[model samples]
Target: MRHLTQNWHVNILGFVLFLFTAVLLLIADNLSISYKEALTFYDEKNLLHYLSNLSVYFLGQSNIALRFPFILFYVLSVILMYKMTADYFKYESDRLISVLIFMFLPGIIGASLLVNNSIIVIFCTILYLYYYRTYNRHNYVLLFIFVFLDNSFAILFLALFFYAMKNRQNQLFIISLILFGLSMYIFGFDTFGKPKSHILDTFAIYASIFSPLLFLYFFYSMYRIGVKGKRSIYWYVSMTAFLFSFLLSFRQKIYIEDFAPFVVVTVPLMMKLFFHSLRVRLPRFRDKHYKVAALTLFLLFVNVGVILFNKPIYLMLKQSDDHFAYNYHFADEIAQLLQKSNIYTVTSNDYKLLKRLEFYGIHTDKKSTNFISIKPLNVYDKKFQIDYFNTNILNIYYVNLKK
Candidate 1:
């Protein structure tokens, strides 16, 4: 097993798998900013994701090209997950199983493909955890990066504090606390209005992401493992973060995407418990080979079935095609319309449509030359004469900016 893991082909195969998934996501529709994400970006709610928006802006506003960086982050996240798992488990086969589980999980796949902060959070969290496990004097660099990247990562301080207390590293603990404070101050807290009493819905969302049956099995496995030892601190911290996020949602609505980091962090440990349980089977089964095989097949079937029927998977597939048809599919037509008309800026009441136009380089800024408003009379001055109007899937209007 060691020799097989050490083989150059193993790394090659992993890279090939990552590349295949990346390409599949790149081609998928709605890889561009979603409406919710667009609103956040436009409002400058989280500056950490500014890089993502900047990539879109710099790529000449092409949504397809914008997904390239995110795809790269997703690939790196998979690699980090493998490394973290290998660090936890001594065996190469165990590490490989953890990586495969992470790669195939519906939640991981959906988070990876979406153009949002979830992938960034997952990538940074894994990278930070890897550095934390291999703690060296230089590893503090990851802490700084994590804090600057996202305020939500402040949750990591809980684990760091525990580690510091256990190791008598008071200075490190103080430093992490300071960084957490700075992160909160810089990014500000995200508040989604008042929290809803949707605890059941929150659990359902998580189940949907991880698959209801698989998540139940994971919970059972975790209970059986019973946290202990220095390494168990990580698990406890991850669960704390997950529970905190879940509970916080009761007041300020946290989306499942927000829990991506915690979920991804706990996966390796869950798989560890699963593999451990398989090895320490009941003594009643003297010939355990067939039993083990059957159990493995059943688990695999459950996970695969969940992935195949996941609602987000179908939604993403359909949304991708729909977004392309309604948006990118009309790129050339919109561009031509703009080019022929004396319109340099276009305004729309629909923010999604406006952002899509901006992405297509249609100059949605009202300050630009040749401005035209596509909104109804209430939004634009009634005195601005309407030169032309077309109503289709997208409304286009050529209004006289002068008046």
Candidate 2:
């Protein structure tokens, strides 16, 4: 009865943590539509990001509603992360701490609110990994499903096949190879093309995501895991995947979603390493209760500091109008103005802005010669154009075309 009650309390605490994290993400600036989000909305390339588009299409196209699917997937991924951590680490506190760190990661938070396939991919990846680690059979179904989520995930099959081969799981290796071949046939071998050089930009992106301090800790943890841990294959696979993603990021336009797998796989390992270091260095602390309390408080402080102080995190939480492609605060007003004026046709060099306008129910006519061109009044044009909506973050002008 005592153990059961204690478990209940821990579960409740984890639920509360999830709720708090969700609320913060809900209120963050990234919840609004951005250029990348606009691309997802248009989806001209017909990529495998059907889930993201389908979610938006079914969810009423509202700013807040569009985020719900991603949030739901994000929560699911976090839960799976906890399960995976619990399975791997004996210490209950370490499991909880790992989940907490995942919840607070800036990359995870920002990615969760955007209309991108990354969150979904992360969720599927974690689920597949969790099942791979815990279940002895029926994991091939997950591999089959993952091929549809993103072509990049197909790389994981190679890692799994290698592991299976090394461990003498010949049946699993054969299945993985078959799936890999099928994925290649369907998704094509295009992802393996020559890499572009984005070495500096990629490094900058990683630095921003993990922050300099956390990145250092992550690197150190990877080093320790590779050198000391028996399950070194996991570390090698994770690093290889990260490198592949990093190199592929330059070959094409990749977003944070593309890096979600790398982040998901590494963060828990880093947390485990951190806790192990704590135990080793503070072995003299006699009171286990006090030690847990101190460590918990320290981690909470660090997470809070990261949220408040990190430049990207600060911007995400600030909720500025300029953060989005269309000024969300003034969206309804702009829509109303355009509708009232009977300005159905519009043109703009800023395609993202046009897409946002369209999402808000303002249609654009590319062929119409005399349509309104929405542009910044001061910056884009100094000529006499009717000012439609003007704000610190955005400016709109109604220019009459000579028909």
Candidate 3:
């Protein structure tokens, strides 16, 4: 009874801490539209139109409702992450260390706070890994269903990699072949249709830059343990993936939610093995002080690096206007202008603007002229919506209402 009471107290405390973190994160700037917008843009577009529609269903067409569903998903993801850390590193000490590592990691924390696709990817990846580690079976099939939510070829590839990790060779091979075919079709590779650029070229470029490094690291770690047939396969998969990402990363807009998990899981395992090697040669390399110093230095460098790279980007993005609000303001101004102008369909090269306007319940069939910039505008042609503050755009400016 006493132990149960203590456990309850601990659990309650944990929940309180979790809620505090989540609430602060939830309040951060909402620069991007939730997955709800993407679905609404492409699909039948009912029940899931705005973030508010997730909780309190206000049937009014003004595009506002309760936001609890999105908030709930974010909170649930953080709680599951806590549970995963507790399970994977079962020892009390290890669990504490793992949780600290997760809390400090820029990618993990930044994704948790946003309504972006990355959080969905994080949830799916964590759940899949947890189930795989726990059941050691094709339990990943259950997890793969959620992967479609992320729209990432890299994640689909990672899912196939997970399937291949099992001892069942026949099952792994069949799954891999299916994934290969599916990837080709969905990603605009060969056979599905011709992409603007060759998929093989992208694969080759990423592979050349990152694969050799990943392979060398994998080989060095594995060689220490006598690399045999099945164990060696892991490196091959890692390299193949690294190659795919090298091309994908160049696009700059590709979200990390798509591939961060692969690095998070794989890197830790590699480091663990590296540390094990260091331990074996501890006496020759250094005494206790040196070993501690090395580990501390390595961790410090990683912590600093993660912060330097991730925080500024997340902050800048978080400070921007939420996609819905930005478009909403723009549309209201346009609607006022439309009252005076005879124009209806605006030709816009900006895909995001088109999507954003649609998300805010503004109707326009943004047609684009062949010229990328400044072509003759017909009096019948509609005005192109432009945000005045965004500096990259020079030729476009918002004509004020008084004018």
Candidate 4:
């Protein structure tokens, strides 16, 4: 009966993951190409761009095509999160909570649909953790292998070096130290334009990334580990990145990506600390801990809902640009609208917008007669609807100069 019950729990976990992936596909279908995505798709030749090009080539250029790889990264990250939880957390319930929280994290959800390296970075970092803990001797092989993967891995190497030093794992220390130096040499840190302080902005971004309530507990979890709890390799990695990112924020605005991936995998750590706290207390005193957990989960679920149903957020915004996802709108819709008119060739004043349109069968021909211009008209275009309500996202004009 016990074995059967364990299998039932495993089935529940598998079903939940399937549902999550389905939700991810739905969100990706709704997303339009952003200006940053335009830059990534057309200008850059990084790993992500190369994979995206391949996807779009095989699948045709659609939002789902552009985003499918990132969503796959999301799936891998979720599975790895579960694996990490299985290691760090003893109980089935604790492991389940950790995986669910990670899947619902606002940052993770957004990264999965956008043209960014965050999801992949998260996937790689967690994979490294699973390897580091599971395989003792061969771990540094992966450690050294990561030097060429990403500039962000420099932060990972730094954290690993610190962990090695603390635990006196000489092999891990030397390899991570060498890898850290190599990564810095190849992808030098760019702290330029970071002279100004944006500590408050950094805090706000983190809050939004994890949701305000969960981030609060994440911070507390780190402090709790430092003050009293026994720390593990994962804790060391997470704490190092958390401190480094914030320390840099005191000087200049830090790229949250460099640090966030390292810290997010610590959701298991945060859950472990939470459950430990609740269980250690007397039953009567545990009410506060339960309340905190309930509130945090509520916020996390709300954050996920807001992201999945973000089209409706346009209705609340005074200016379309003021909307949080404003960057990912306009281009695909406008391209489709123009293609219907058999207008395949045009030049836009917005260079980025023009490039994005190219992905959807529109091409830029400079010195051509057709000119595309945009204005901030609040009138809804009957052509482009986000869900059932059409958005007045942009007013585009196609000026014809044919004599």
Candidate 5:
């Protein structure tokens, strides 16, 4: 009977994952290509660039096609998370809850639908963990492969270095140090910017990723584990990334994408710490943790909801440009308005937007000489208010001819 209940819980999580995938597909369909994505699409070359190109080759150049690979990665990551939860959680329901939280994480959700390596990093990180726990020996082969993959895995190898040291695994520690060096050499850490502080900005980004209160708890969990609880390989990997990124932020703005994957994968660790603390307390005395956990979950849902239904947030912003998603919101609508005006094959001063427009069939030619300048209209204007919201989200774009 207990086994039956366990199977039922896992089955229900399976259903939730199915629905969540559909929602992600819908969100992908709605989002326009951002400047960064457009740059990646045309100018930049990488693994994601090739994969996205291949996806569009078969599925055609739609938003969903562009993002489908990452979405698939996200599904695999969720499955890996479920398998991972068994390591920390005794209760089937606890395992289910941990997996479910990982699925709805705002950072994970954003990564899964965007044209970047974040989702793949997450999938690979979890995959490595799953492999390390189960097979143990073959993980080095996986770690070797990670060297060429991304600079982000430097954090992974570094974490393993410490874990290996603690366990006195000489071979593992030496290999990890070599791999970490290779990753840095291949990727080349950027110290080009004048040294300044972006630690506050990094903190704000993390708050968004884990949601506010949960991020605090996540920090607390890591500190507590380091201070007292048993520090498993998982905690080491996560803490190493978290500490490395924030510490570097004081000198340079560290790329959160590189670090967030490792940190977020520690969800099971956080859950284990939370539950252990709660159970250790007297039932009547546990009210504080219960309330904090409830509030944390509430904040997580609110963050997820805000991310999924972000169109409404435009109304709250004092100006459209101030809207967090302004970059990813305008290109498709702009292309549609231009096509109606019979303006095809136009060039733009905005190179990134031009690349994005090109994806929507707005080709550019130097001989054609049509120039477009884009400006966002924050106020209500009768000119070219477009998009599904049927609000004044965008304004008229003036088209010109070169002299």
Candidate 6:
């Protein structure tokens, strides 16, 4: 019975976390088609188009099919993180704090519920942390697979991991670098000079600039890791390489998942200090500090509460007034037109209608999936005719087939 209680308590934490995350994600999924619409309008539509037409040789499933797998990966990541935190700290209180902090992480919370590359980032980060804790090289292989499955910018985690390994295993690090290069080319990025003007721009720029100054703090913490004696050159070089990588990724939308490895490394380095400071002072004025800490935690949760909860609240209220006015009208008109038609090709400059239909699960024949430009409307291609359209930007239409 005692052993059962212990195991129950142990597994229950992760179970609760997964359940909480699943609930939050469902809320996001149910709110509206806005988020998915944006995904289809921007980049996912191209990926989906590619997936639908993929060669027989490919092993991956379709775009929509990847969503649940991605969610499961994210759930596994948080569970792994909680275990790593618990194992590292040893103290139940500290472990609890770590779990709560991770749950409320502005970046983690924001990304976990969304069906995008951010979830990949979360999984990679947690996986790296777990690897660091276990000193397992096999985890690196998993990292490689996820990096391949994810988009190009996701390679940043691989770069950071290799940077950490370069000191002890030079050959392994070099191999990883080569693999990354090959992965980039194989995954569809042009390896030639200045391949794409906007390629990895978000990870290479914007996200890099936002890294916490804690990175510099981590550098000092490395001294405590005793890295200066035998591997001083490797340590310093690795730090410089990672810093440079971060600098290069400044403008890129690298997202928090890319930085997960870096974040996990700091746990061991900083946990002692966090605890020592708390122990020394926490005993002197218990109630006062407790109150202050509680308030701070509340504020942090509230800040995230706004992003995770309030946004949907506002969206739901706003949606009530026009719940069926625009989308239903548009869908009804189009569904009626194509109810019996054998059209297959669709060409439209406007992504909104196309994306909304896709979001609403309205599958149809082959879609051209091209962006309409303000310059001209090209509806008269050999493959498709202007069965439906808006003159303003060629909003929506159908070709002659079925999906």
Alpha-carbon local distance difference test for all models: 0.60, 0.62, 0.44, 0.81, 0.85, 0.46
Cα RMSD, each candidate: 7.1, 5.7, 9.0, 2.7, 2.7, 9.6
- lDDT per residue for candidate 3 within 362-401, as digits (tens), equals 4455332211122234432233443344522112222222
lDDT of 5 by residue, 1-403 (tens): 8886659977898899999999999999989998788777777788888888889999998989989999999999999889866656777778888889889899999999899888999999999989877776537888888888888998899999999999999999899999999999999765435699889989999999999998998999999989998999999999999998889989887779989999999999988887788898899999998888899999999999989888888866667778877788878887888788787887656777787888898987766666666564343222456544665665655545543
lDDT of 4 by residue, 369-393 (tens): 7777665334322333323265554
Counting only residues 3 or more apart in sequence or on different chains, how many pairs clash (N, Cα, C under 3 Å) in candidate 6?
Answer: 25
Candidate 5 regions exceeding 4 Å error are 1-6, 376-383, 387-390, 400-403
**lDDT by residue (tens digit), candidate 2, 1-403:** 8887779636765777667655755464233455555666676554424555676678666666656777787788888887776666757777776777676666676567666666777777777777766764537777887776566666677767777777778987898788878777887644332556565666666655565556656766766776787544456456656666666766754554455455556777777666666677555663663565466546545655555333343234333343322333444455556777666667766566677767667767776442433444543321222222332333356655552
lDDT of 1 by residue, 288-348 (tens): 6456545754665576554433333333442333442233233434545675664446665
Segments of candidate 4 deviating more than 4 angstroms: 1-4, 376-391
Q: Name the top lDDT candidate.
A: 5
Model 6: per-residue Cα lDDT over 196-228, one tens digit each: 333355333322222233333344455654453
Which ranges in model 6 have alpha carbons more than 4 Å from their true place?
4-12, 34-68, 138-140, 151-166, 184-246, 249-272, 280-282, 285-295, 311-350, 361-403
- lDDT score for residue 266 of model 1: 77
In model 6, the worst 10-residue window by lDDT is 385-394
CA deviation > 4 Å runs, candidate 2: 1-5, 8-15, 21-25, 28-30, 42-59, 189-196, 232-236, 246-256, 283-345, 367-391
Which 10-residue window in model 5 sums to the lowest lDDT?
A: 376-385
TM-score, every prediction: 0.70, 0.75, 0.52, 0.93, 0.93, 0.56
Off by over 4 Å in 3: 1-20, 23-26, 29-75, 81-90, 113-115, 143-168, 186-240, 247-257, 267-403
Candidate with more favorable, higher lDDT: 1 or 2: 2
Show the colliding residue pairs in model 3: 52-66, 206-243, 207-243
